[model samples]
Target: MTEHDQQTDGPGQSFESVWDAIEDTPAEAANMRMRSELMIALKARIEARGWTQAEAARVMGVTQPRVSDLVRGKIALFGLDALVGMASAAGLHLEVRVSEAA
Candidate 1:
């Protein structure tokens, strides 16, 4: 890679990967993506348990349509707080940790 590209990517990181680092995105966009990913993961877990959206809604205290939206990756419409609440209601605890760059 060119020196400019290496510098742009920070040290030796490459942009050739299909999806590279997005961790440094602005707060709003990062939260949006995080919420979306969490929703998808939660929906998958619910399905893996062989549960219907209606059942999941009952467990999560949300309407079935909300669960459907999550399953469909319309995550931008929901906030991280809402997702965290739903996850807890659905018997999933959200765990996150921050560490210094390694």
Candidate 2:
């Protein structure tokens, strides 16, 4: 891999989820995980439709800055409720599951 393309794992390489990999507290990690997943889904949907960030913002009923944040994966700038609302506005169905932790 090129220098820029190479990733140095550190200890987080052992974990599956980004939240878990960073060793966040359980609640914090779960929150971050959900935000990350929603952002990814939203970005994918926008790309699938060949929409620019401005178009995505219009469709999601959010400002362009908000769409930029979502596109850039600024997880800490969003909460679950906001993400859920955006998903709904985007006509995306979200299925939430709860299970015992491994």
Candidate 3:
């Protein structure tokens, strides 16, 4: 790999998620993890129901372009609240859990 593409951490340093490795703080990483999980869930639900982008958007109460961004895994285009709202609109019940950090 090129020098600019190299990891800065010491050899063998590991993270629970890529977000943890790249985000500026633990809170940011946690937020990204939640957002990513929600996106994946929404995408899977759409696929499972055999819904087109327009159909998914209609069900989620969003525009087709928004659904396109979602299914394309455009994490940077969404936030936690937005994802939660979309999931709810799509009839997905969500639960949050907290645990002590390892």
Local distance difference test scores for all models = 0.71, 0.81, 0.89
Cα lDDT over the full model 1 = 0.71
Model 3 over residues 10-100: C-alpha lDDT tens digits?
7888666677778999999899889989999999999999999999999999999999999999999999999999999988999999999
Worst 10 residues of 3 by lDDT: 1-10
Cα lDDT tens digits for candidate 2, 44-91: 899998989888899889999999999998888999999999988888
| Tens-digit per-residue lDDT, 17-89, candidate 1 | 2122444544554565567667877887898889898998888899999888888878557888899898887
Better of 1 and 2 by TM-score: 2
Enumerate residue pairs that collide in model 1. Answer: none
Worst lDDT window (10 residues) for model 2?
A: 1-10
Candidate 3 wrong stretches, greater than 4 Å: 1-9
lDDT of 3 at 27: 97
Q: What TM-score does model 2 achieve against the real structure?
A: 0.79
TM-score of the candidate numbered 1?
0.68
Q: In order, how many clashes per candidate?
A: 0, 0, 0
lDDT of 3 at 3: 18
Name every residue pair that clashes in candidate 3. Answer: none
